[model samples]
Target chain A: MSTTDTKRIVIEPVTRVEGHGKVTILLDEQKQVTEARFHIVEFRGFERFVQGRPFWEVPVIIQRLCGICPVSHHLCAAKAMDIIVGADKLTPTAEKMRRLMHYGQTLQSHALHFFHLVSPDLLLGFDADPKIRNVIGVIEKFPDLAVQGVMMRKYGQEVIKATSGKKIHGTGAIPGGINKNLSIEERDALLADIDQQMEWARGALKVARDYTVENLDKIASFGSFDSNHLSIVRQDGCLDLYDGNLRAIDAEGNSIFDQVAPKDYLNVIAEEVRNWSYMKFPFIKEIGPENGWYRVGPLARINTCDFIDTPEAEAARKEFMAVTDGKPNNITMAYHWARMIETLHSAEKIQELLNDPDLQGEDLLVTGERRDEAVAIVEAPRGTLFHHYKVNDQDQIVMANLIVSTTSNNEPMNRAVRKVAQDHIAGAAEITEGLLNRVEVAIRAYDPCLSCATHALGQMPLIVELYDADGGLIDKKVKG
Target chain B: MSETITFTIDGVKVQGAGGQTILQAAQDAGVYIPRLCAKEELSPFGSCRVCTVLVDGRPQTACTYPIAEDMIVESDSEQVAAIRRDIIDMLFVEGNHYCMFCETSGDCELQALAYRFGITAPKFPYMFPKREIDMSHPEIFIDRDRCILCARCVRASRDLDEKAVFQFVGRGPDKRIAVNAESRLVDTNIDVTDEAISICPVGALIRKKGSYAVPYGQRKYDHEPIGSDIEKARKAE
Candidate 1:
């Protein structure tokens, strides 16, 4: 075999991520990584399946998009339905409660990502022994941090369960407003945990900062690239997750467009397909289709936002800035920083929402007359998710088009994986599992939920085909 | 115009529209017939057998039995009640239904119908099969032990929601609702909104993350059926 053929590497079924994915890299005869391919092997047609259901059923139906972050789908779908149905008619209390429930979801999800999923890769070495490098490992090695993470996550789950009726796909959040009401006792219980959660979140941030700062070499070793970042920014320009206009900023930290409406996301962002994978790449409109690569999720959120709203979160953001010079564009390290910053923000935001008096006895749901069409947008843990629906006269859903955040960044993730794989290969003899794992983890930094993004099909086995330097099929493996 | 078919139900001389099923005529006349698996939102699946009524000296599920001209329908007879009780008993015995500790106990349709028929105990020995509880989903829980295999959730998923998140796995009495391809609910594509949880008539299917708020007797259904609430929503719409 030629030197280039020896350099070609393939990694299948990237672990600890939400869904199934693979990475392949091609190198030249000199062993220089030439091309990287990140392949999504599954399809989940959420938007297509939602067509012809009742508009009111959209939230309930779309909530099934992801088991881990059902609230994101629930809120996004509800907000989209609100837009079609007219959001102004909903009571202020209902809106606030919805925001609270959504924040609760964000808290748990971010915690899960940081502590349970990616923390092991960061705290322990990415190449740490697989058996001792998971959430369970965290529990045995760093018992205090693990307990804090689990408890903090539990607190968030409790809040979501209390408001939504179920922890996963709570029926409490509906089209017009929420379906369940919150009581003073529940509010008080959440408040009781707020201080503890904030404390634990602070500790988690400290741990992240210490680890990142100590391992700056390792953190920076992960390939960093120039890509535009996108997220939902509040009207006042503060970071907002539940409801806000979408914002796209270039790699130079310049805003591409401000206040792009949810329904018009397709206009601002376009999806590109590659036959190699099911995931479609999305890019900014102004960047000229092929050149406009944008990133979302934790790194994107941090880059796009000016400052964190809460005090502790702002401190964590400062520490995050210390590592990446204010805007970290490295896709691999973004997972670590994003988890840290989001954990802080989630805790801080939950405290703020819980302190609101209206949350006690406020009207949870607003009964409104159905409209012909509606749209909702929310910042899921991954990125900005959009839900649009058209209802017939009988209020049944006529059509639905959901553009999940993970789907929007699918192309960029693939590109990032390829870039990292090529850089890490650097004329090496072959792709090492460490290099391929980092590439996959780079995608996981965005916390890509393939189930939510693909939106089509069920647990079909993943077929991964390996190619030699000349694109010849070398080997194949099937993963369920 | 087609010729009209007249029918007598429960001693009421009811004028039926042509081609209307006996159950449809009875429903049109505001007469109520107990049905377990009949959801307005889904196609009629006569799996529950609770809607059985005597038609022309034979017991048949009203949902599947179409209206016949001069059909003598006995919706509530001693024999019909006995058969309904037997079916309910079989369902109760086939699954592990410990209603006392169940979240949906008081408001459960199966339990309510059983109580109405004065069925205090199962005639057959309880098939105490071990079942798994899937808490993989952060939001919902699935108690396979409490499932009676009604297939309502499965049908609603495939026919109405079109997500097909739920499917029947295994065969015979060993059959159960499987979320996605795995036994674990979290790993599956089944979202919390799929309504499979709400559609479950027993405690077998449950919302995982939120169970404590109502404090036992104060559930949303304590005062009314979900059907009535849906009716109000429909009327408003």
Candidate 2:
């Protein structure tokens, strides 16, 4: 056959995802993959949106940033506001209530991403018929696990509703403290299903671990790379999702930075904007942008932390580490297992919190000398989230800056897409459905929230368009 | 004038003082005429017109319209209810009333009235008019987007608080609440404890901080409709 001209493959609005993204693949004259770019089309101007508004309202208003993880934004903003009010030390009731809410968010978000979004590809074959390779397909083939996922998600949401005022965009946390405490009735209701929730959480973890161990070889090289990891850890180096100091480690698990204060985030992390993407690439300031880009979310958090506080999750974490001979697991797909471990830990923490007397205390708020500026960081279900705000003397917000988890993972996601393209699509004679699915599998492992990354509002329908080198449309595929 | 007057609201007998308006008399008789601007603590401004009732086959604002002997007021009749709904709808469209993230959502009288009337959305298109936010005060702020021009704050400030800190400026579509100061609330003498700060039926005039502090199912009007207290009072009697 005569040499075919170079072509570009476009995948617009990747399916089974939370936000809008388009993947472009550049092929050379020999049909070898030359470049792959993941473009974020979602628009985000939330920082400007909150300007001139009262600092007290930031927690509520910022929830509009992303529907999937509004709780994370809510808690993080409240944490920043806590510092502004000079309530650096929250009351026991206030701290416990906020922790319960955060853990609830982690559990629900992780469950939704794993069961509803990524499970179909794992439980069913990646090359399975597109029509049946979805949450619906999971429900059809494995009804028990599907129901467990939905119920577990519902349980987490109920916890949020009980702590916050409502399930969606809750008004639970306020400046200096929280709005309400867990009443006996609410606590009892949650306690009723605690055992079952723990059971299901363990089951989900088992599913992820078994699949990873069985397919270790195939996935060890699937979209995998060695880079730096970042997250927050307890003072003693336990995995602390709700609050802690920042810790970063290289691929070999050496500490790059430890115990950095949230207020000094600008001294370390910096964001660089690229022309091709709406989202900015964040990197370690000292290392420079080129090689400083690091990974966040579940895998990074697990790698950066010293130990899991919960018993069963600690066991699981040890097993996960042993697989890599006590090294940071660099495989992209390991995010699933790390995420499940967090889920189990969240369940354990929720049980501990519900039984604590602090959650029932009446002292819910505290105040002290005021501050004009503050910064807060939390481990959102996806990764590390940063919130910084400067308030005027009148208590109005003068400035706001948010580094969302998905935005921090921008370069890593692009690299993941490129790796998948190289392994599956480079020099292929024909682009089969299985090959396209392989690319999606890599992207899904990170569980990216393009909506949060771009901070824009819209729906996404999957559309894949194939174009020739001359810019002629060769084929189109769509799924909603 | 007689000392007392006998009237019927929705065909139910109600007796009240001769000087009382229809809304006051109805309240005395455990009837609620779903109001926005009429507060017992302040003189009725009658700007919202949400309490419109058909008195003797003619429309009248129940807040300002005095009751007469043997007057038949159709407060809950379909005609009157429809008129009230339309007025509430217009109030919603005239300004940007985003109830979703509004701090005063569950506790807002306007939102409660909307819930009682089942107004999921306004029948009219939103004006989406540009509005100013006054956050200059250390203890208080105002979001004009959620303002309904109810003037509760105006009446409470002038008549109750006696500060005369608030007043209505402009006319018709341009009408808005104006503070005594040249531009911002900080320049005025109004404190966070002033009646005007707490009199707002919507999220317009809010004290700084402590928004959405009330949980769901326990907000002022969450479990019951806005006027259910009055109805309950009647039933108790």
Candidate 3:
């Protein structure tokens, strides 16, 4: 085996992201850890493909990037399209509808990451039997909790479907505003589920809190690294997932940058291309990649925000912030904990939006003349996603640049993987699969969207429709 | 020549124009004929074969087969419906139709037809055949993987827009749509305002710079199924 001569370990296609990962762990001549690398191999070339297309279709087209959080891409592209359409401020109905839909979007994505992707490691132990180390396994272990998770995700999807027409890719988000109002029937249906989901969310918070407290030592040491954190917050420093001011907190939890607009992204954030991977390395221009690389998504949001606006999430945030001891929390495993707090916030936000009468208000859209250039940002379930466009006077898109959340987290994910590898793989007593599991746990902690990372020639998942005798849909089967 | 004709479809007496096809007669008589390429404005080009029906004991494309006297058409039978389902399934396998992430998903004719016939999964293995995507056209881009070789774009460009910019190249599995003007789409004198852009039944030929103008919930096909308007019109008649 090549394990002896070079002592380099190659774990191909890390499971549960399900595919498209190659972790290369290099060992020194003495078999001590030299360096570990996370290699992303998917490439869709979205930037190149969208070149000559009309900027108006980018929201719908680019939203096809990920099925899990298509709404994020849809909304972000819609915001950019809004700027292109010359909408300085959105209509009341449009703003509320987008906010409601985005909450559902974040809720469903976080539910998926926690229950389906990250739970097996938390509940069944990281080195648990590979057969039952999945969402299916969660069902076998804690049946009721798994059901709750499914219901929570269903709750999110149902809200999305009712408002957006479809959960995966609906035309709910248009430039300047949305295309439809949240009908009374749809709003009522979502409102009815709010109380039940709130209970489930509180349950999730308890579960996450218990686990984090119980395993603080192991969780802190396992994929832990001290670095900066970046997320968008409101002007008052409250958490704002949809629209906010950019905030960056250093290792000591001190503010390095604050309240920057999406247009000025070029000044602060820049990409460093590496030959080894298709994903770009994003960093703060002031510090450079060596120290500029910061974490995003749940942990970043939780660390940087002054307080969560919601009552329930605020309580959770207060408890979560205690772990930082006035500094940015870098315990990578705490991402799961931070995720549930945001989920609780989403559930509360969903209920709040449903109660508003303007959710069903009229004049959902507004149109205008074309703007030459625009950039839009939204905090996706993972992290901040950027969609920038340069359109011609004729309204044709000349060029497009996308900085998806997974790409932003590429450096940190690799660093976490490297940390786990250096610790577990060094002086290995024959390098068992259990040690390898530790490295995988690090990557999973970030809940990285590999499909969006490498953008591997964007695969179109195949689905066949089945209809009843009355020409009504009976079933649909999807295959990739 | 007779001014009108009568046809029996699924034991219902249907009335239509004398020279019209069975699909047209069925549609005129308030029956929905599942089709991908056959549009009202365009001349019937039976390329997709999705509108296949049992003409007596044999299968025929309803879009091309003219309605004759006492035509015993089995358009709604489980057997004929299965044939239509098979055709849709073939189309699904033959192209890179990823409806899950397609821009034209809900409003796409292929998808709407699939929904009408109740196709859950294609019987054939997905041939993820590599295809080219031309983003050269400033106003529009075509994803060849989603093209079903319906030739609607070709005909629409030539007949409607009167600019024969798109043409088909190759044959069999290798057959695909291509640009007639060399040096890519930008070199062609195609305009974004051309009516041909709306003629595409799939996500293949999409207008650039004008995406997601309509949100998902308020899209053309949301709430109502694809052919519901025709069915509703027939009911009103």
Predicted model with the maximum DockQ? 2
**Could you give candidate 2's per-residue lDDT for residues A3-77 as a string of tens digits?**
357777888877777788889888888888888888898788889988988888899999888888899999999
Instruction: Report chain B TM per candidate.
Output: 0.85, 0.97, 0.95
lDDT of 2 by residue, B87-201 (tens): 9889899998878778898899988998999999998998998889988887788899999988888878888888989887888788888898898888998988888888899
A best-first ranking of the candidates according to their lDDT comes to: 2, 3, 1
Tell me the lDDT of model 1 at A75. 78
Give residue A167's error in model 2 in angstroms: 1.6
Model 1 per-residue lDDT tens digits across residues B117-191 = 788999989888877666556566677877877788898778767877788889887787787765577777777
> What tens digits encode model 3's per-residue C-alpha lDDT throughout B66-122?
988888888888898888888889999999887765767767888888877777788
Candidate order by decreasing DockQ: 2, 3, 1
Runs of candidate 2 exceeding 4 Å displacement? A1-4
lDDT of candidate 3 over A174-253, digit per residue (tens): 88898788888888788888999999888888888899989998888887889899988899999999998688989888
Which number leads on lDDT?
2
lDDT of each: 0.72, 0.89, 0.82
